[model samples]
Target: MNAPAIDARKWMPYPSAGGAPTTLYCLPHAGAGASTYLPWRKELQPDVDVVPLQPPGREMRMRDEPFENLTPLLNDLLAAMDGVWQEPFALFGHSLGALVAFELARRLSAGEGPRPAHLIVSGRRAPQHPSRLPWIRMADDPMLLEIVRRLGGTPDEILDDEQMRQTVLTLMRADLGVDQTYRYRPDPPLDVPITVLSGSTDSHVTMAELEPWAECGSAGVDIRLVPGGHFFVVTQRETVLRRVRHCLVGSP
Candidate 1:
């Protein structure tokens, strides 16, 4: 089935200033909108363009229905990003975003396109291992709230507001549904070099769990332990961006 047509540019609200030699396409963690990485442009511009992808049902795409499965979500992304893939680029995704980025990288590697130079994944276990995290797609609303609150990214004000809380939970469930339903199919290892970043104290993903990522990429995988937990992508923003820049541009 053909994925519905979407204005491709809408996915990137903060495009590079057009002077960078390469681009970094970023995918957000579950329940997160692209705005989460908005500050990245300043961190990696001229050298690399930071483009964060905004999935539906979040931020400006709030009214659009979110995809509950990874296949259609990726299909839509592939269709929408047809032109954007022409340039020299890399991918970075955190948590659920990590899985999405990994799958996307595999697709690009197998298909016709300029494959990403690097794949940077954070706070998610390698696909080869079964996810140790709880499957929260079917959890009740209160449970969902607790899970989201425990995850530590969503603002307290949003959770406190009735309408806002509903909106957040709806997006979270749909995104988590994508995670719960995803079944990783074996494929040849990716051609791109991969950098796996894990939080030192991440409650969901341990340092040991990141080891299997080496098998997923033939180009070589570099795994590093940084500070904080699953939400370290935000809490340790500078550290994350620095590592990402190092991976792609060889800076510092």
Candidate 2:
């Protein structure tokens, strides 16, 4: 039978019919929620149990305050993860979520906590990549909005609706704050296999930035280039599904 669901306050499984032999924990991009990975169920079902980690302050927990720092955030994430850490599991993260997954993996690799069998990171550069700016969260409204718009980070539909526009901006700023404030230090490479995925046309991340991720893990890295921009996880879902399936199949 599927492990009983975590507090539902944190991790939400797609279809809730879990009890699969393996679990895939999906982390979301900035300003996104668990629902963002809902489609993953159709692509990875029967063989893999797909669960999305939901932090406070977004979607169903809209009333909660967003995270401005990473330490406390990671602590909270780990606490909520206690239940599902059982069995063979993998982690898949995109963009901001990728960084979170990497750091979490580092901690898990240290010991005590459960380490994932595989880590699939997409649309993000390696942790050691030098930072270009102090903090995008500190950018002025017009400047920040312009960057998000130019990068297609925020949808136009959300921008069109005043209420949603404000909400999106608010949550995005906090999420970006989490990213901006994060500082990566050198850590021993994880023993788990890593898969680095990126969009062919994603200007924010280049192939050079992705290759370094291979050095962060000892189990070897497989780089896959999907055809799309920054949001390839959405636009190239099938490619991601196939790649993840291939990774899981090859896992021990």
- The Cα RMSD of model 1 versus the native structure comes to 1.9
Worst 10 residues of 1 by lDDT: 129-138
Model 2 pairs whose backbones collide: 2-19
Estimate the overall C-alpha local distance difference test score of candidate 2: 0.80
Clashing pairs in 1: none
Best by lDDT: 1
TM-score, structure 1 vs. true: 0.94
| TM-score of each model, paired residue for residue | 0.94, 0.91
| lDDT (Cα, tens digit) per residue for candidate 1, span 121-181 | 9889988777554677658999989988987778999999999999999999898888888
Error of 2 at 123 (Å): 0.4
lDDT of 2 by residue, 1-252 (tens): 975543645555343456677888888988899899888876787777788888777988798788888778777777666654746888889998998888888877777488889999999988777544436766776666766676576779888788887787788788878887788787778899999999999988978888889889888988889999999988888878888887886432
- Candidate 1 accuracy as lDDT: 0.86
